[model samples]
Target: MRQPERERPTWTFLTHHARVLLEIARNPEVRLREVASGIGITERTVQIIVNDLRAAGYLDRERVGRRNRYSLNTELRFRYPTEADVPVRRLIDMFADRR
Candidate 1:
């Protein structure tokens, strides 16, 4: 017999990179440690992801005082060729605060 669905699926739609981006999009000054806690991930992992994003031109990091600040490259399109034309701003906007 078929089994019932679990309370939560094992897979998620948004990638860690996407999650980090969205988090920063909402609050540019947010701390990476906070992002990790909010995302249920390790701070070191978040740091690695941030490095990847920066290397890929998805994010720009600036050191403001003691904490680092992030800025998204809104005009930059997705890396995947399938969605290369689609700017990441659309993705960010899709998950923007909705009330």
Candidate 2:
């Protein structure tokens, strides 16, 4: 017999900021709409999050022709005390595709 499906939790280990950063890292040329849709958030929220990341020095945005390209600042350290010494690259590598 098949087991019952487990319920999903309301919280996650990664925050919206991390999610946005990961998405941008995955595709630097990705549009806000695509990131929003992929992350299940509003485009406006993505815009705000991108701004936050930029202001925090975790992301760099550059205009590439008609679109914007994002570059991750992997050298930056995490904000939390527990992982404060860890670089952003470590977190990104955890979720990044191996192929």
Candidate 3:
């Protein structure tokens, strides 16, 4: 008898937003295209994510001549109240320290 095929899982613990933020945290000067490739998302999507982060005051962008430099607002708290006491810094540090 043939075995039944298993379906792939569509859900993930982390959202695209968090993945984008983590990518930025990993590389302060990373390119959006690179971020998109790393996250398996489109460059346009990465751009939108960056805009969202900027508007939320979670990050700041600085024009560094021909290239753009990004700075994170680590002191900012998570949006959800469940993690209200946690600062973005802690989250960044958790992943940043891995490498």
Candidate 4:
């Protein structure tokens, strides 16, 4: 029998960020716990990545009661393929209607 492909190391790779953003975009109201579970990464890493994205002007999230509403800026250009197709700012705007 063939063995299953091993999971990739998220920290060592950059595509993880894009993948994470896509997931968040799919469900703006996704919780940290759910994100960590869905992405197969630690919550700490999720927090770090999220902070990095915000710092890079890739995303903007608003506080909605106890949860957050995220927006994806699909206009700003990204330096890498991890953000090639979509703009960082566009992602932030996706949640504009939430708050």
Candidate that would win on TM-score? 1
Q: lDDT tens digits, residues 1-99, model 1?
A: 323456545788999999999999989999999889887789999999999999999999999999888898988999999999999999999994531
Residue 36 C-alpha lDDT in model 2: 96
Q: What is the C-alpha lDDT of each candidate?
A: 0.88, 0.88, 0.85, 0.70
Clashes of each: 0, 0, 0, 11
**C-alpha positional error of residue 65 in candidate 2 after TM-score superposition, expressed in Å:** 1.5
What is the full ranking by TM-score, best candidate first? 1, 2, 3, 4
Determine the C-alpha RMSD for candidate 2 after optimal superposition of all C-alphas: 4.4
lDDT per residue, candidate 4, 1-99, as tens digits? 322347543254436676567677778888867778775778888888888878877778999998898876666687768867766556435632342
lDDT of 3: 0.85
lDDT of 1 at 70: 88
Candidate 2 residue lDDT tens string, 57-93: 9999999899999999998999989999999999889
Compared with the true structure, the alpha-carbon lDDT of candidate 1 equals 0.88
- Provide TM-scores for the models: 0.87, 0.87, 0.85, 0.67
lDDT of 3 by residue, 3-92 (tens): 233543467787888888888888889899988987678999999999999999999999888877899999999999999888988878
Looking at model 4, which ten-residue stretch has the lowest summed lDDT?
Answer: 1-10
Q: How close to the true structure is residue 22 of candidate 2, measured as C-alpha lDDT? A: 90
Candidate 3 wrongly placed segments (more than 4 Å): 1-9
Candidates 2 and 3 compared: the better one by TM-score is 2
